[model samples]
Target: MKNKRLIQKRRELKLTQKQVALAIEISQSMLSLAESGDRTLDDANKIKLAKFYRVTVEWLFFEEFYD
Candidate 1:
């Protein structure tokens, strides 16, 4: 799922939750919730994260769920 992928990519990039939150202009709590699958990202944020990770939006948003 997107949540798992987000967490995975965050780890791969060696980004602390605070670092990822700051880069994405979100709060650390929000990022934590997102990684735990307690919340879903807004479309704009999905796009931003995709770009940050150099991944296609499809890969970031729907890869695990859809494919």
Candidate 2:
């Protein structure tokens, strides 16, 4: 699934792709690929994003399904 939560969190914080990428030490294009779900975040990057957004890794990357 696409990382809608990640997109939402960034938007909610009024952050630009470049801003986030710079803060997290990645290229803007890399972050774009991640946000678009064309690339997966490795564990280290996941931790960085979660910390940057003040959320848990699960909240950033997991989708809850209803039974």
Candidate 3:
């Protein structure tokens, strides 16, 4: 499913897909796919996103605890 939380968090940080991709060492297209629900974030990237967003991986990937 599309990760609205990820999109929201990225926007809240005033970040772009390119910026987050570069910071996490992934391709911008990959980030785009993940955000769009065409692909899921791998475990490593999940950790990277959590760290970048200053949240836990569970909070980042699990909609049940997103808030």
- Give lDDT per model, in order: 0.81, 0.88, 0.92
Clashes of 2: 0
lDDT of 1 at 50: 86
Worst lDDT 10-window in candidate 3: 58-67
Error of 3 at 38 (Å): 0.9
The candidate with the higher TM-score, 1 or 2, is 2
Better of 1 and 3 by lDDT: 3
Please report the TM-score between candidate 3 and the true structure: 0.91
What is the descending lDDT order? 3, 2, 1
Highest lDDT scorer: 3
- Compute the lDDT of residue 51 as modeled in candidate 2: 98
Model 2: which residue pairs collide? none
Error of 1 at 12 (Å): 0.8
Ranking by TM-score: 3, 2, 1
Q: Is 2 or 3 the stronger prediction by lDDT?
A: 3
Q: TM-score of the candidate numbered 2?
A: 0.89
Off by over 4 Å in 2: 65-67
